[model samples]
Target: MKLFNIVSKTTLTLSLILFSQNVSQTHVYAGVENASPPAVGKTAKDFSLSNLNGKQIKLSGELKKGPVVLLVLRGYPGYQCPLCTRQVGQFITSAAKLKSANATVVMVYPGTAKDLNTRASEFTRNIKLPANFQFLLDPDYIFTNAYGLRWDAKNETAYPSTFVIGTDGKVKFAKISKTHGNRSNVKEVLKALSSSS
Candidate 1:
């Protein structure tokens, strides 16, 4: 009788352990139903991603300072996107103005999980980013899907998008560009930042 009791208790403990493991392993991303950008006035979803230097950057943490201008680039479609390069450069030129407006620019460089670090480093080899700007990598489109910005089309990685999230964590402006050359420009982003409360 004592042996039977011990065996039963052991089985119960094993079952509890398995259940806890499964519960804790709940997936972070379940993919998006549609590829629409988060609506204006909607509370932005919090996401954490690794930067070029392997440092984790969380969107909510950056919002603690002020507004955040999120740039989602078309990452590793085939070669480096010239349009993306130009867009990044344009924003970098106006970095000081953006800083004065109390805005944090968070650029998302997303691509496949294979050697993405190397690709991202190559993307920013020469251009210098200001202190208020952060370069984050979205490996395997994890962050993109989380924000509903994944452009899962042929020869495309992510939809070139821009969003302005206020300190209140509400999206003030959102733009998703389906084509390569029609991305949001720096003037519009700065304007959004200035208008954000």
Candidate 2:
């Protein structure tokens, strides 16, 4: 009876282990699928930005899966940008489509550090982000200037920009808009993402 009890216990343990392994393998994969955003065929410039939640995020770190869509958002330019709001919403709505392609989207919100978090928090309040999407704060225009998107005008911040980068850390496609509303549309970015990956 002791030996029989020992065999049953081992069998139960093995079954539990197998069940756990299956659960782990079938769980939904989350996080950035891994990528870059620079110029087509040019090596992307690496960058790190803090999210409104005070977490640091790196470009190369996100590109582990190959393609990433980068959006440069106008941060608190005297007020929240309506175009940015609309564009972000569109992206969020299309999150499932983007994720299926194994792509990650990174949005950069740039502004002076003063009251940046408060304003950024306000900006993010209404949006629900998916696992593959990250909204990063570019305090004091560090990333804006580095990427040459700083507008440097009164009540103006970074110029709106969109980029598609590949897993090899190369900019596959890049578009910079001089005017506030002259940004890339969702279709174009989606196309770039499919092609880049």
Candidate 3:
């Protein structure tokens, strides 16, 4: 009877351990379900991330100068994302329009820690960033997670997102794209920048 009681207790303990492990795995897998996309009229969350030059750029600091157009990019997912490249090029083409409307453009490239700096520098190289534009690196996706843009699992970096922040430090417009191809265009962002009151 004593031996049977000891075995039964050990089994119960093992079952509890297994149950805990399952719960933990489930929690990790259940990534952002009901999170609504960030919207206009909300205060855009401020972040300070390092640039390729290792300089810290703050979102709030940019907003102090004028409105800001923020773009989040996927970085180094075993290959450069062509869709991100195209969207970035479009923004570059519209630089004048964004600046004319008193807006600073910032592109964030997020990647894993191993190659974040190298990849971010490579991504921005030779691109003519206007005086009002900056490229930021979200190493290990700290800022991405803060903004709820982290694509949980499958080795994904982050979901593409754009925010138009007003000089008043509030988000004037926001577009969060779930997939690769459905990002906000430069024209639409320009319109929002121009129409911001």
Candidate 4:
């Protein structure tokens, strides 16, 4: 009877452990499975997030001007992403062209709510944003998960993605990189803007 009780308790503990693991993983998988970025021909969903300056920027409001460019960055995923810096630099270098194209560039820096604003400030400390550009923050991965662009991995916040939305609110161009690189180039985004307009 003693041996049977021991075996039963061990089996019960093992079963509980497995059950708990599955329950945790189910939530993660559910989030991933439901995440789908807007397609090129589909209408881009409108969302409002606060910029570093505590000002709220709405997608629909930006689209009211002409076109909107959305850039999703891996925000402070343990550290600033080098690839994101290079990509944003390229866009900054061609700021004049983007302004000429009448496109409002909105970059999303996503991370946990803890110190997100500070991290975003650090990311842009040395850089000057053009008049046509805006840096937005996604606290606790709210916007990231909403757009289905969450990386959901170790030391990762959000996937590096880019989208050009036309005045009609439809996505004209979209590029999502699974890895750190393969980001959308400024020239490509300019072309997409030109055609969209």
TM-score of each: 0.85, 0.79, 0.79, 0.83
Q: List, residue by residue over 1-197, the lDDT tens digit for candidate 2.
A: 99999999999999999998888755532211222225578887888888877889999999996588899999898899999999999989999888988889999999889888999999999899999999998888777876777787888998899988888888878898889887887788888877765
Candidate 1: pairs in clash: none
Write one digit per residue (lDDT tens) for candidate 1, span 73-143: 88888899999999999999999899998999999999988978888988999989999999999999878
Model number with the top lDDT:
4
Best candidate per TM-score, number?
Answer: 1
The ten-residue window of minimal lDDT in model 2 covers: 28-37
RMSD of 4: 7.6
lDDT of each: 0.87, 0.85, 0.83, 0.91
Backbone clashes, each candidate: 0, 9, 0, 0
For model 3, what is the error of residue 83's alpha carbon versus the real structure, in angstroms, after optimal superposition? 0.9
Question: Pairs clashing in candidate 4?
Answer: none
CA lDDT, candidate 4, residue 55? 97
What are the per-model C-alpha RMSD values against the true structure?
3.5, 14.1, 6.9, 7.6
| Candidate 2: residue 20 lDDT (0-100) | 89
Give candidate 1 regions above 4 Å deviation: 1-27, 31-36
